[model samples]
Target: VGHLAVQIARARGAYVVATVSPGKLDFLRELGADEVIDYTKGDFTDKVRDIDLVLDPMGGDHAQRSLKVLRRGGVLVSLLDVGDNTRTQAGARDIRVERMSVVPDREGLVELARLIDANKLAVHVAKSFPLDQAGAAHAFLATKPIGKVVLSL
Candidate 1:
């Protein structure tokens, strides 16, 4: 997610600004974000003027609007949508738009495994029902779950 990108960017000595839900302000702060904009508060385009890069996965109009915050010499990488006429015009010459997809990689998987092994990452398992109770668990999942639900043996 963008949170991970922000962390990686900061680690590489880039001045990073991130936008997240208002409820996640504390979480973003803990992740060492320099600026945290709450998307629910107002239009991020209005306040976040001039940015170097925009990493967008949540597309539709949301991705289109984010182009407004891009500086003349900036980059916008979208994971979930295509760059329409609007994105092209907004970008112009200096702006670069890349339609990118994050593919699964062994190196990334290895790093993830290391994080899990070190306990640096936590997996939230919401429910673990017996195999015989899978139907009940599936029913519970219909309501939406915060984490993984396992059918244990």
Candidate 2:
């Protein structure tokens, strides 16, 4: 999820900083993340401030922590469920908080396909698990990404 975000954001001309565990730092840097934070070593909120935007796949309590890194009027878009308190506080800072879910739509799908065809975007699949081992796929995701994990039928 984050790998896709990094690629698209870079293509749009934004400098991206990826928050990742230590071992994956080099991989994310290679993917065009200008700066990589090792969450295992320190708190990103403490290390970073005045960010323009955040594409957070980590939901829940992380939403609030990410808010601290945003510049005023910046946006934090989450792919996971965030608690209500995070939304309320964002309003105070003039920051925008939105929870996003991918809706299957033909136009959007076609647009993404076009990007792929144009060579402006790509998908990186890290590992595939058998359909029966969906649990293992989920477990692999908890570790830092190589890219998307797939369920191989």
Task: Assess each prediction's global lDDT (C-alpha) against the native.
Answer: 0.75, 0.86
Each candidate structure's TM-score, on Cα atoms with residue i matched to residue i, is 0.69, 0.84
Clashing pairs in 1: none
lDDT of 2 by residue, 63-97 (tens): 88999999999999998878889999999999998
Question: Which candidate ranks first by TM-score, i.e. highest?
Answer: 2
Q: What's the residue-level lDDT of 71 in candidate 1?
A: 87
lDDT of 1: 0.75
- Native-to-model Cα distance after best TM-score fit, residue 34 in candidate 1, in Å: 0.7
Those runs of model 1 whose alpha carbons end farther than 4 Å from true positions after fitting are 91-93, 105-153
lDDT value, residue 23 of candidate 2:
75
The top-ranked prediction according to lDDT is 2
lDDT of 1 by residue, 100-152 (tens): 87688999788767766754444556689999999999998886554567898
Model 2, which residues run further than 4 Å from truth?
A: 130-145
